[model samples]
Target: MSQFALLGKRRFAPFFWTQALGAFNDNAFRNALVMLVAFQMGLDDHTVSLYTNLAPALFIIPFFLFSATAGQLAEKYEKSRIIRYVKLFEIGAMVLAAYGFYTHHTSLLLIVLFMMGMHSATFGPIKYAILPQALQQGELVGGNGLIETGTQLAMLIGMIVGSALMEIAGLGPLLAGAITIAVALVGYLSSRGIPEAPATAPDLKFNWNPISETARVLKLTGQDRPVFNAVLGISWFWFFGTVLIAQLPNYTRINLGGDGSVNILVLTLFSIGTGIGSLLCERMSGRRVEVGLVPLGAFGLTAFGVDLFFARPDAALIHGLNWLAFLHSAGGWRIVLDLTLIGVFAGFYVVPLFAFIQSRAPREQLSRVIAGNNILNALLICCAAGFGLGLGMLGLGVPEIFLATAVLNALVALYIFTLVPEFVMRFITWVLVNTLYRVRIEGTQHIPEDGPVLLVCNHVSFMDPLLLMANLRRPVRFVMYYKIFNTPLLSFVFRTAKAIPIAGHKEDPQVLHQAYDAIDAALAGGEAVCIFPEGGLTADGEIAPFRPGVEKILARRPVPVVPMALRGVWGSVWSRRDSGLGRARLPRRFRARVELVVDAAFGSEQVTAASLEARVRELRGDRA
Candidate 1:
């Protein structure tokens, strides 16, 4: 379906607006509060900074205190009903905010900030979980992209409008109250239009206590490794983002030398870059949750962040320079571009990770897992605040902090990649596939999205595994021969990818046992393990006889077996059929259409070596 269909669908459009309006109103009221205290009442710089930082703390506190309860509500009750209640809460919060504005009661305004947080906290699980229920699998990326872009844009606009309105003589409170109430009313109307999302766990008992429910949700997420890892990745993105964005205000004042205009510029550049990247996800991903983009994004983030630090103005701070003059100054324009690109890459980094978690998570427990993720995010944001404060106390300047954050991002990316090599491996494969051949995957639905599964494919070329890895959304552990697994330069790649190397029984019994044990463990952990059932590469570009080793593995593990066929790999330079004398002798610039066809999955009881081979052979047809 087209991406626009999401807006036309009753299920997604209402929730999208409700979320966008909520984000707009949140930022609007917060910005209005900041402007009221800072400019209208002429608060000290220290007080302004404290209030700015405290706002995040107040907002995030609800996620920690109430996210688990919110997840349970989303799972145990119809989502539409819950949304109506949340919208009503938003309206009530706006009423409190209106009162706070009329009385000029800063404390009441702070309390209203917490109330807004509570409203958002309750909406958090439903926001993510409802997408998978309402939209088709193909529309998930687009739907998420729209929501992300809309929210970011709303934040930018809300900050601008709120600040502008507060500066007016008599329009401040009226504008704040009018906008907040109108948006809340519109959100409530949208909530009424949201289609019914049935409860995934209707019988689940409600837990009013936060601590125990938080622990329960976390434990449930631990049961799914991929989903859990994706959650970690998402939370890390927030950590990185909080740190980066927090530095922008100071970076503009001290480094860019453009007063308030610089703040707007930074926000505009970063938000626009992120929105562009978010929208591009639908196109770049080809309508699937392509995680390879995540690594690509990480690379760009580090590259741009480091460049931004170096690109900062060399001169000491100057006063009264507008954004245009600032840009015309030495090294100023480059810094702005670098920051914008960092945000762009960050968008690339985060959007796909969210989509991956949503798509891979269990339908019944998705909301609970999202709640766990919210708790983690809140914890990380707090950590980020503490880290930033510590750095400032230690006499680190804003520029140095930016540089340190960039370097720290590189280190964190390295650590995460080291822990899960599948990210790096998939990145390499994505690069190769996109650069070399245009790959078209058919029958992707035939592959199970969950549970243990064995994929049997024809062994065609050295790039076979890379091809399959790039196409499949899930991480797959491949079983390769010892020789190929230990190849000089490729050995590091294989090892990093966590591929299992097996030797023939006659060659090494110990290695064979280890390989089988690894496969069993991977399956028990609910991972996809792929094996070339033919055992060895084709000697003459033809399907080889099936080996009984696959049958042995199945006998032990008893997982579903999926037959996959590869086309157009036989003629590739990496193919076993290639008899080139040297690297220069290999075929150059050969254009071939590569296809990875996924056939229906078969149970272990129905899949013998012979039957599996026949199924693969049929799919392979006359092509190798």
Candidate 2:
């Protein structure tokens, strides 16, 4: 089913609107307050500046201080109930905000701002942790895409509405206050439809001390090296976005020589591009959480950020113009495309990381880990402010900062990818499998979610293991022939995936023993292991004789044995189908339709060399 089909379901639609409405109200209030302070208030420049700058700090402060407490609450109680309470708090906060707006009381409005911030901080854990429980693994990526798209679109609307409302005569405060209160109340009503998401760690003790608990939660977030790096990648995204979005106004005036309308235009393109990119993630990922998109996103962020600098080189030549006028000017299309594509890539970069976190993080503790991510994101936003400031102090222009940020992004992405090679490895495998062949998988549900399982398949080409690794949700450790395991470029991927290399007994008895030990250890430790019972790729577009090694392994440690067959890869470029006098060559079939058919699992005792081969042959029929 298309992910959009989720919108028609009771389980998803209500919760989605509640979250989106909450985002709209938050942005509307902030933008209204900013507009009021900037134009309506009869204050001097210094006071206006003081209040405007302090607003962001007040809003974000709760994320740093209360996120740990919030994570604990979500874990200790029901998530749906927490969300309702959060919505109630929003309504109360908006009431206070309404009164402040009517009274023109700046201090009261700031307090309401802090209250809204606290509400968001308190619900941060529920926002992410509830996803895994609410949707299936296959739907997780699409669900996240919709959330991202909604949030960005809501932000755009709220900003525009909030700022526009402040300019109206006589009834501006009444209109703003009424809209916020109504939205909050509606959000609470919407929360009513969000079915209960039971607590993940109900018996977990609450840590009242925010400082210690915050540290502990963050430590847990880093427990898995890959998860930690993914978290870092996400935080870095917020940092990069903070810098780019925060500087857009300055960049417009100083570099693009554009006015307020042009500023809105740039922001619109970025947000729209981000939404477009986010929506495309599910499709690009083949309806799975494809981390390969992460590398692709990082690459685009750097490439376009650098290009944006050159897109507007001579800002002095232009003067203040409206968005339309700016577009009509020379080189405008390039600038707009740069902004839009940058946002698109940003979407590509961020969506998968969230999916990865939700999918890969320990389920019971997912909320706490997300809370830790929120806390880190808050910190990164602060650092980005400092980074932009440092650049300004050096007398560099905003465009120069853009250039510097792009350069820094490249370095950071390289460092992160190096620390976690699985991301890059997956990218390569996904590219090869997704682009070079249209792989169709059947009986994926038959693959066990946990515990040990032995997968036996007929190998058709050198790319067999990679194809399996790329398509299967669960990671597999392949038992590969020794020489193929050492194949030059492919070896890096095998090593990173921790593929076990086995040699023939006559060639190397010690290697064979070690390979057996490795297979035994992997299964005993409760991991999926795939082995080609044929012991090698087909030499003449046929299944080689099934070796008895699988029987030996099953005898050593019995597990559910799954049988799979590959069809149509036999004539592919990766297969050595034509060989004569020790010479071999590949067919020219690229992007072929290859079918991966998996039969129901057989008991280890039920599986034998000959019987499994017969079943696999039947599954493949004449295709192989």
**Tens-digit lDDT string for candidate 1 (1-624):** 667678888888888898988888999998998888777766799988888778878998999899999999999999999999999999999998888887788899999999999998999999999999998777888888888888889889888888878888877877787788888899899889999999999999898889999999889877877677778888888888888888888877777777788788889998888888888888877777877788888888888877877787343467667788888888877877887887788778888888888887888888999999999999998998888889999988787777787788888888777766666766776677777667778887877767789999999887777778777766688899989998886676678668899998999999999999999999998889999988888767888889998988888999988899998777676775555333431554354577889998888999888988888889988866
Task: Give, for candidate 2, the lowest lDDT window spanning 10 residues.
Answer: 578-587
- Residues 16-113 of candidate 2: C-alpha lDDT, one tens digit per residue: 99999999999999999998888888899999999999999999999999999999998889999999999999999999999998888999999999
Best by lDDT: 2
Which candidate leads the pack in TM-score?
A: 2
